[model samples]
Target: MEPKTISTARTARYISLGEPGADIQHVFFCLHGESQALADFAAQLVNFDTPERLLVLPEALSRYTMPAGPAGAPLTVASWFAADSLLPDLADLTAYLDELAAEVLAHCPAGVPVTVLGYGSGAAAACRWLAGGRTHYDRLLLYAPVFPPSIDRRATLVGLPDRPITLISTTTEAFTTEAVGAGLLQDLQDVGLSAQHRYVSEGPLTLAALGTVGK
Candidate 1:
């Protein structure tokens, strides 16, 4: 017997604010982090809700029982990929995200600025998709981006130098420690892409306080 592969459509869960009729000056694409729920994560960003801005939150396609729980009933959450199977999963995801983004753009007027922001694991997914030279947006905002160690910088870094990327990190967060954060910036520089690094006062990962990036 042989394994099989299937191609089909899957529901891409998402939420949006500041519809087409308002004075929308900017369109934002935000990817929620691992174990984060779409509705809850989107709720925190409601402050970005304004007449001049439109925000989109695309939910992760995969869900699982979270690990390292408090030794009781497990909690359910979503994630972008599973290490056991990533590339193939993301291939399907990137296609869906591209289509979704295109549809979002279709409703907006011409020449409106676009920004894509992702937190933690979400940042990794967004970067992986953009790595293929799609040029979907004017700017990319990554808060503590976590790229897989297996990622080939040569391929991922191609055609991205032109995109303005702001890498935000906090004063404290193991994932965004000095060494890891510095290395990421250095890696970008090595590939001819210079990133702006900003350190927030101190807190958990959140995009609401960052204000409108790429403005």
Candidate 2:
């Protein structure tokens, strides 16, 4: 059958950590890797949590069940977007993120810094969403980032001259080679953007590993 498409309203779930009230210092917008759940991903970043910080974990719009062996239990996961409908999906993603950001920021105290962190596949999504220039953030952190060609043209537009961007990865990941991470940082810097590549230990991210980032 020939493929067809349509739009419909749906509920997208996100997790908000830390209490909202006075004394809030920072707000984080985090995106997870492919096949990752919002809650599970947030658990890994608990080290980054604090009384003055609010963590917002937004799951990708697409959900799927990963294939499993005969005895393996079914696993459900989410992705930021699908290649089959990239352009439209990207537009939709930016709109959704804009709404999410606005909703969260409405309750936040004025002058609170916002940090956008994307991991693995979510890195591309985060970059694209920020590229749209719809939301305001104080910093960009990409963990195991993979960039698309479009980001090259829009790099300077994401407040690169003023905002800091960091490419983060662990030492053990094969993709975190000096050539790959440094090349990305260099590319951003070439356009007059403040960018850097930081390496942590070969494991899940922790506050100690990410010391001084977004500071």
Candidate 3:
């Protein structure tokens, strides 16, 4: 199916692969990291052959050109929420996700299993999205996510049930260090989110790895 695009209030864009009506049983929301576009993750999902899987990539609202400081050296852009700014306000993010989710649901069917995957700050956005109860996603996949310092780990745990989420981290990546990753795992568990943390070797993220966790 031809891919469709949507414009968000943050002035960002989102891309989708597979027909909106292709019997979508599962939806994958891939939130890109800093300085990355939705297409960055879309390329990986294109490698998969699963007809039932639909991938949606939403670009961050904020745009930051590549810092190489050369004319058109290589433009790098990211979503507004991908930056390492101070602690994020959950309410603001929820509003953004609410708008984006509405656009997504407009083109897709209802009751499809939703999976949210966030890399870096995008992970934190995903967490906030889940916590806000704006969308009914079945699974949340966090890849090297950074949690907000202001986030009350205990408070966030109130509504999350056990075994509905999975956290994926890398051992070699500086962002997902063993200590930090372990802390996140413990926090999720304490909140009764039913999370499983995995330690992968340093390497590129792939659909195969994501599919493993989705299973």
Candidate 4:
């Protein structure tokens, strides 16, 4: 099939933890990996449920249904974007993500530190958003990151002041590992970025592995 671009609207679901009227100190924007839903991922972050910290989970625009093999039932989840539609799709995503961040911050208390966390595929989208110079956050964390290798680091950190760009990965994750994820950090630093690579543990990357986040 030929490719074309069209605009459509779907319900954007954002699951939040912590009360809105409470004295929220920090707000986190967390994105899930491929074949993962916001609801499932957000559930793992129950530790963030407090008056001090607020967590927001944004659902991916695309839903993917996993094939069932020996497993009894098929699984359905979401992905940030499709690799096949990077060109125009990324442009659209850049705008949408920028708007989403702005909208979220608007309702938040002024000067609250904002952190954007993305896991795997979601990490890739997080990097893209940063590279496109869409919005600003206090911290950008990528867990078990899986992003295009050819991405330009200089372009990715454009116009942003030097800050810690953290890459959080595990030992057994398919893509970003303890060693390889460091290379990503180095590349970012080479391009005049302040980057850090951290590991939560020596096993697979899971939501439970990341406890309540802090600076």
Candidate 5:
């Protein structure tokens, strides 16, 4: 049988860390990795919370229950996209994120700096959204980023050259290594894109550690 595709809608949730109003000075769009809940990811970034900056955490649409511990409750988490549903999920995510960002930006004043941060598997999602979505960010920060093969490098070259892209690594990165980080930076630099690699200690990746990027 031939495959068929259809579109549908469902209610999704995202976490906003700070108020969205005239007092807001910066906006941070953070994407979480696979098997991670939005609330859990928000906690990792709670230290970055400030009165002037807004942190928007968009939860992935695809969710599943994880194997619970013998005495623990059932755990649920989300992934931005699965390998089998890559294309369709990408389309849905792009639309969802675009709408969410637009709504947040609408509440803020003009010319507020927008920063996009992606952690682990979320790095590619941030790249995909920025490549195709309508929301424009001033800088990009990837923490132990895992860039998928499906990412559009050409689009990255075109869209990201003028903007800064920082590939953040640590002494104990679980997925990405120092060599991998260096190579990714080299590739971006080869294409004349302003990319850099930075190293941090083994700890929670925070905005304070990544001082003055794209400033």
Candidate 6:
């Protein structure tokens, strides 16, 4: 199958991975962190080893550069939602996700298990996607996510009933010292979501652990 492309004037990009004709029983859609591109975690799929059978989709957003970076340095970055600067809104992201879901459905057969994985701000985007009701996924993996102040955790919890979610954080001393991370874990659990929090010594999200959950 030929590779398909999606582009916008804002500079967002999405790419599909794995064998085209293989039996695709699982699908993984990853949302990248702040100031980071999809390329950062694209290679990490090898650690999962399930990419060959799972259709992986990575999406990039359009963002502006910060003048504070350096003297007159123009930086271009991707973001799912606006942070400090005025960029894309949640509606833009929701539309993109709708298109993405349609594309994934068109590429694969029915009854395929789908997983949505988000890191940092991507986590926020994933949560918003789940709240929007555009698509239904089997699992949601969050890696050191930073929640936005505007999001109402209670309101977002309405339609998501007992969805399986995994929260993976760094085990480094620095992260442990910050109680905020632990607080987020508690908050997620308090909302009646089937959530798991794991401290990773050092490694990206892997499929080995996720596969066990799927089974």
User: What TM-score, computed on C-alpha atoms, does each candidate reach?
Assistant: 0.83, 0.84, 0.76, 0.80, 0.89, 0.76
**Across residues 22-88, which tens digit of lDDT does each residue of candidate 1 receive?**
3678898888877887766766576677678898888888877766557755655688887757777
lDDT of 5 by residue, 9-118 (tens): 87888899987999988899999987887877887787678898899998889988989889987778988887767889888988999999999999998989999998
lDDT string for model 2 (1-215, tens) is: 97787888768878889856668888889998878867668877887788888989887888888887599776778977676677777877888889999988888898788889988777878877887747889888878776554444345234343677777876675653532576667667666777767777645577655556535
Steric collisions counted per model: 0, 0, 6, 1, 0, 0
| Greater-lDDT candidate between 1 and 4 | 1
- The sequence of per-residue lDDT tens digits that candidate 4 reaches over residues 96-183 is 7778778877777888888888777777777777667457787777777766544444466564456566777665545544335766
- The pairs that clash in candidate 5 are none
Query: Which ranges in model 3 have alpha carbons more than 4 Å from their true place?
Result: 1-9, 44-49, 69-72, 79-89, 157-163, 174-180, 204-215
TM-score between candidate 6 and the true structure: 0.76
Taking the tens digit of each residue's C-alpha lDDT, what string does model 6 give over 1-215?
86454545454477567644337777777787777645556665556545445545556556656454456545545766655432236667777787877676666767677788877777877787777757878888877777666666455655464678888777665333322257667677677665777666545556545545544
lDDT (CA) per prediction: 0.73, 0.75, 0.65, 0.68, 0.80, 0.65
Q: Any runs in candidate 5 off by more than 4 Å, and if so which?
A: 150-161, 178-180, 213-215
Stretches of model 4 off by over 4 angstroms after superposition: 67-74, 149-154, 157-161, 173-180, 202-215
TM-score of 2: 0.84
Ranking by TM-score: 5, 2, 1, 4, 6, 3
Model 5 collision count = 0
All candidates: CA RMSD (Å): 3.3, 3.0, 7.4, 3.6, 2.3, 7.3
- lDDT of model 5 at position 126: 85
Least well predicted 10-residue stretch by lDDT in candidate 4: 203-212
Using lDDT as the yardstick, the better of models 1 and 3 is 1
What TM value does model 1 have? Answer: 0.83
Candidate 5, residue 52: lDDT? 87
